[model samples]
Target: MPIPSTLIGIPASPGRAGGRVVRVAEPPGEPATGPAPADPAGEAARIEPAVELVSTRLTARAATVSGDAREVLEATVTMVGDPALLQNAQELVTERGRPAARAVWEAANGFAATLSSMGGYMAERARDISDVRDRIVAELLGLPAPGVADLDAPAVLVATDLAPADTAGLKPGVALALVTEQGGPTSHTAILARSLGIPAVVGCAGASTLTDGSAVIVDGATGEVGEVATLDEAVEAAAAAAVVTDWDGVGRTADGHVVPLLANVGDGPGAAKGAADGAEGVGLFRTELAFLSAAEEPSESRQREAYVAVLSAFAGKPVTARTLDAGADKPLPFLSLDGEPNPALGVRGLRIARDGSGGDGAGVLDRQLAGLAAAAKETGAELKVMAPMVATAEEARWFVERCRTHGIGRAGVMIEVPAAVLTADEIMREVDFVSVGTNDLAQYLFAADRQSGPLAALNDPWQPALLRLIGMLGEASERTGCPVGVCGEAAADPALASVLVGLGVASLSTGPGARAAVGAAIGGLTLAQCRERAAVARAAADPIDARRAVAALDG
Candidate 1:
């Protein structure tokens, strides 16, 4: 008997969905044996043509990709064209007398182990190279391209995994839902689906076991994927329901009051869209996007173009652009970063900015500050530059001074570390404003990984301890007469928006689609009511009680 199944995973996209499964399998395996090479040197000579062919093909397709994808491919090209790898392979062939291809394979594996050990951005680059090498080897042995489902029609897509590049061309309207056997909530597929508001489920075991044309129903909100027939009745029952209202502006309460709605954007194009969608301004424009997608440090002109686009998109509205916050987790290949036992706590954010260690080299902060200042001067845009992971007043002052020296008048510090919040007044004295990066702040506060499944219980933003910390920051901001805002996922949550407003957040920034809903929720209450609700929430014993308190306030 075939039991109806309802697999659950992370929701990457959002929408109602009912469709058939389209399974895409992994690439086929390579042959076990091949024609023997004549000699060591001869073997090396024999493989030269194949290496050149792979190199040429990669170079030819280089222009097709842009932004982060382009950077990944470029690094791939570099690894394939690495003279050291080829040299090592040739040496191995001449000394050990191995087949040329086999020698290259062994050499590549050794290089890969070194890369894995190095970690950081180099490790990510190495993985890309390894992937390409595998594909090239397969091609050389006459194997077909990796299995790819023809997404010719709209269906609930199921696969073992998906690459970021594979998701770039996904047809938003047609692709109603997706399920993958493996992927974290923060992976590229999940991020893209969420951005597109498409329903998705990731990390579902046996997700690929579902055959093609097998009917399924995906519930993005709950991360549920079930057989279609099992859900068809429910789908039919809800088919006649009223159209969903647009919830895209400033959140409001029962009674209307104006609340700032903002967007956390990564690039110029995204900023433009967010602004068009009625984002009051950019809450967090991650400058790292400019750096990540480049072979070298982006030229001042290129940086200017990105900055200007974002600033112009918001027009006279304020745009808070955080400087390069790269670290071990999101490293740049060109930057020489040593592997850290605990990277999150190691040299990252302001630590890296101040120390110039971990491959930033001397004058790294100066160049970043100067570029941002120049971009501001050229665009004449209302831009505020902030430093991430600021922990102390001294660090805040150091960053502010650097920005001031570069002619950037407005400087802010991200309140991600506990020390920053604890010393908010001192830090405020050295900067223009403070924006709570609640996600990391909460993670650090609770000693939990926001991305870890086992730590989910500790990751709730509404936890009383986290709320108290936020309240402390709010009180400090009030005492110092400094504007305080929140630019994190918590800022957009409807359930938490009122408490945040009550906590005296001057602005609440989230994704573009969530702006209206948050704005509407905020509009329903006055500052005094929000404060009262926040007090009730703070005084509550647990998240459950706190949520009830928030709900009462909303009611």
Candidate 2:
């Protein structure tokens, strides 16, 4: 008998899932142009309010979601308010005598097409732009915006591509796999799927050809979609593979080198959830969520209340909290930062705190530190405050001094910049601990944008150059007597996590779902084995060879 057809796509998430395919309906086509208004200015006047309404809706959605999904929706909101898009559309309506709907359609599609044509990560953003277009056009047409809701049963979602909004509402475990016709690995669909730990395949041209209700197998790690096994078998295999879940407690290698397993969380609720799932402590507690959710700077009392919740959840356990990491990608109107040609290299993280805020009388950083102090006093949580984007010993000392003044016992700096790594010993003397943010460090180290799927190879955690930098930080920890931890996506990979511990990463913070698997991987190897693998990885030719070297350790 002939084998079933298979479609290959970019693997967005790792895992296998199988079920009957369920196709979501395509977005509605742009409606025919309505009669041109007698007064073009009056038609143009409708633009702002429509944009405002969509912004509010997007903001509402963002509030309900968290993590990458929230970021995607927020980006869409920004696009909806884009001056260029609005100006071009308004010009179409006023000058060309087109109806509001038609003008919006032309403008949004023009913008989206341009981005999609650019290829790579820019093309991936086309979905978000198109999502905004759909919302605005839907509002003008007096119809509900397109989305996927009301799935009757477990399904493998098959579509051309899922918008950020559509993927946000899906309940975990309900969607077996996400297969998209067009999207790269970093697309909203892929990011959301990874967070959910589900199977997903993106950029599959033939994905839309799959029949609704037809049984199909999806290997998300391999980006393969075909009929190889029944859905029941896949579930059974997953259950079998999850055997290591029973092994819990402090992470240790087979030869008993201690490795602390921690969680990366957004808030207290997330921290508590991680703890319940066997997290030893909170490795990364992002404080920006509170600020991102607020219209203005949250009061010290509000920040204190928020901090207390996170601290209380971890209670006596260590919690490494990052102070407000705003600027550039996350701009606060209250913060006075002039536009820069390269915002990535501009006032971001701790640098934002240095800009001298002109809004509130007390500095934003001061308030944040004060809140951390209050939370520490109230909960007696082992809170360790940290700053992002600290590149020098001077900045490290300043942040550490501030933490100490505020009565927080511990402070650290995220050593993601190249300068930080090169001068890590000097910075280590100023701070209590160091955390390596491999994600950004890799991006900046390689000059490869992580957002771009084409540059994904450069950002791979297994890259020898990245491992070498990590090794440098590890050695610095020994020389300076400051513990170093890895609080990045690299810590989530089982094999990579093992290599990380071998390289002298004292702690590993990963998503709660990954903590157990990482711990288990560590438990399976000895410290010497890990060190050997790390050594081999660093000596490897490249990322592919580095990963191969690490994989050989498993054998």
Note the residue pairs that clash in candidate 2: 254-525
Q: Compared with the true structure, what per-residue lDDT tens digits does model 2 show for residues 474-504?
A: 9999998999999987787667888898898
What TM-score would candidate 2 get against the native? 0.80
Instruction: List, residue by residue over 492-520, the lDDT tens digit for candidate 1.
Output: 55547888888778888877545654665
TM-score of 1: 0.74
Candidate lDDT scores, in order, read 0.69, 0.78
Each candidate structure's TM-score, on Cα atoms with residue i matched to residue i, is: 0.74, 0.80
Off by over 4 Å in 1: 1-5, 27-144, 205-211, 230-254, 289-306, 327-343, 356-362, 422-429, 438-555
RMSD of 2: 5.1
Model 2: lDDT equals 0.78
